[model samples]
Target: MSTTSGAAGAAYDVAIVGTGGIAAIHARDLAELGERARIVTAVDTDAGRLDDFSRRWSVPRTYAALESMLEFERPDVVVLCTPPGLHTGQALTCLEHGVTVLCEKPPALSLAEMDTIIGAERADAGDGRFATVFQHRFGSGAESLRRLVGDPRLGPPMTAVCHTLWYRPDDYFAAPWRGVWGVEGGGPTMGHGIHQMDLLLSVLGPWRDVSAVAARRARPTDTEDFSAALVTFDSGVVATVVNSLLSPRETSYLRFDFAHATVELEHLYGYDDASWRVSAAPEHEDTVAAAWAEGPKGRGSGHAAQYTALFDALDAGAPPPVTTADARDTMELVAAIYASSFTGQTVRRGDLGPGSPFYDRMNGDGAPWAAAKETEVPA
Candidate 1:
């Protein structure tokens, strides 16, 4: 794992791992990157899927296994779009081989898994070669909001509401890992709501504690179909979080209340500048508008925006966006939400470790479904 610049310029040889729905997003985004990057190869266990991906993306090579891809092509980065359970192992292998990784959301199934991934990264110090696909962080809306949050013109962030309420039918969980705690981790809180929470954490900083409750009201799955939490950030800002897969009218919404303005984002999956609005106090109205006008504009929240930034960091020999440290913080928050919910107590940050039950598994010692009232899905 060395950060050797590829080609005479900054062009990188990229590889895609796991040709699934999310992988398609990465492949398409990488294709539009033009000369800045190239999809040298793609990997998947299914030959037919791999072949289709290779043909669709015009990737020069395809492999059924990661080992073969590393041994033969050995591209600059491996985009891990595999199952959540395989993330840590796959990421460790890539880092060990000196290959950078851009993994999808819920970076690791548990904090212990995250620690293992971080250890591998540390062993390859200067490499700093791991990044997660928290693409929401790169959009123009997030960029603008991050700027406003820092600027005193908006004042300190005081409170927020981060909600990811969407529907997922039982057939959607036929993929095996979708609803299980061992593989997919938690339900909506881990998979769906993580995006909004990541965006919220990006603005509010570290959370001090979380008090939450999880339930299985509609989905017939091993994991809780829904979870809600009250999170207190270290910055003194408190927020409410609701993660559910039973909402008929779906939305991924976040509202940040600052001293001078209220900034909100309402979108299902990805967001654009239009999806965000800022309501400023009378005295700070003009100032907030002016500050927001400073452009990081037009870019939509998707893999392209994030991938471009990741490639640029690699090009400049800098640590990429959504580093392991950052991912760990988000994962810890997820752990806290589960721990608090399952135990009926507020989970404080820094309390979870090897000694804590939630440290090794998101479900902790007890089963989430057992504690919550389970609802049977119709056949």
Candidate 2:
């Protein structure tokens, strides 16, 4: 296996695959990382896009395929900004090549695929690690919230709310893969809401079970445009999650109602310390206020912050941030949401495995609306 190790203070080589919108973000963040990382190579099927990205980002090398990049560049890490369907295979390839991968969200379409990637990472030992981009968890606001969750002053988590109510017009789905089940996976729940839900899981720990409902609603898509669920965490914290792609006024919000305080975060896509607010209970107001004030600060949730943490882990020879194991629970929650929505049954943490249909695909028994849409004759 190739080694990720280098002399201390040496910048890790990073090759970004897929020079799309999100890949640009990864490139920008790597540029911001300065000496910690260097974007030595770029890979994309679109030659025009590849050349443009390489020139714009000042990347020294380019390739038409990941295999060619891995064979030649063999960078320490590869940032995968490819489609959901491509993540599993690309990640596995990176692992085989002994290159760490920091993949975009909805890392895989199903729990089974994520498990396979995790298994591959395990086999690689210290050679390569897989981390997912759940940027919300790296922000100081989230850091403070996590610390407070365990502090005696915050008390226990009682209930919570997580919403990813964003709009996507008809034109947004013009891309052939935008709303497809096989390629993009499970619509808003899997793609959009998974971010907030991941942050929720990051703070609350493992979830116990979930009961959900989903519908295609007002979009031309194979998957649900919206979904809602009632999730119960292992700590008995109950939370309501809503993911929608039809809301006119877009918003990403989360509220944690603890015994001592009601912690809330109001933001659109990303959040910082200013996006959060704390309302301490009357009795514990002074202590809770003081504790919250003294917690971590400054860092905001975004690709740059997450990359910073990731580099730190790589530098220390530890597992990268949002390790496949760390992200497995969130991915499981996503699968549970889809499973519960489709099967009309509460799906628990351990309920999905090799035999379960949801284990392999988000649309377990096929979305109920898919058949209806199929039966309808073209107008």
Candidate 3:
């Protein structure tokens, strides 16, 4: 509603398609940036939300559908804040119209859905760029770690661990699509665990194999609210992922162990940022055991912090930290976890590796997660 005009570049003008909780974060960044960008148009399937959006931001353009927004507003960038299942279709639509997209994480449900969009992007030169927000890489702790990744002191990360705990009220799942099998896909893993998982991969590199388990143990939804996964990177690093909405308390953490040192990000915000610790190894067993003290909690909810970095990156014209291809890697891990849980098997990273048939799975009707999902959520 209240935005300055005059965007000059191909990626300058922006539109936000969803007006939910997460969308507000993106909107705030664009709004504060003033003339740096414009929230050209707002859109939602329900339509009533647009009035609130208009009043809040003084936004002038609103549309009920994404295509109509694109047709009328002609923005250069579109930030997708829709639900997880809608990511692929909406992203592909924006790309077709020469709009760069920065969708939220777990970009697609299965390797198959991911493939449809990734394939089209690879083939179309000017369809526009795509990225997902894996903003942990931009966090203060991560920024420090990336700078030293290749240094002799922190060289060759050997392992990583991620833990995320948050409170999710029952009403949070009142939205019909919040915890469905076909729609939301998985629970905390896709919705919650993904942020930590993506951070681990960014630090350790691509995964070579993964073993995982997922279940709908705590929530009423069809998808899982809790999950844990083990990832082995091609670079020989091992990592662990744990995400849960069942926790009464909220905490978030990611730690990496390198050849000579350890790096970590820990905070009270479940999906947000916190303080970081980098330290050397202890020489003696007793000394190491004595040093098992509590660490610092994170400072800000990673939401606003991440947006600061994302908007800065976009302004600089440098590509964001996590691109569409990178987002697919995170989803592959999610898929592998679901597959492993369903089939009681270890999923090879190569099975969904580059050029694998899994990426091209259009309908994704036969996914292992699907088979495992056949059993209804317990009453």
> Which candidate comes out best when scored by lDDT?
2
lDDT of 1 at 341: 90
Top model by TM-score, which number? 2
Ten residues in a row with the worst lDDT in model 1?
A: 1-10
Score every model by TM-score: 0.94, 0.96, 0.82
Q: What lDDT does the true structure give each of the candidates?
A: 0.87, 0.89, 0.70
lDDT of 2 by residue, 37-116 (tens): 88889989999999999999999899999998888777878999988889999999999888899999989989889999
- Model 2 off-target regions past 4 Å? 1-9, 376-379
Q: Put down candidate 3 lDDT per residue, 48-88, tens digits, no spaces.
A: 77778767887788889999887777776788889888988
RMSD of each: 3.1, 2.2, 5.5
Cα lDDT over the full model 2: 0.89
lDDT of 3 at 35: 68
- Per-residue accuracy of model 1 over 269-352 as CA lDDT, tens digit each: 898889998899999999888888885899999998998888778767888999999999999999999999988999999989
Off by over 4 Å in 1: 1-9, 125-128, 371-379
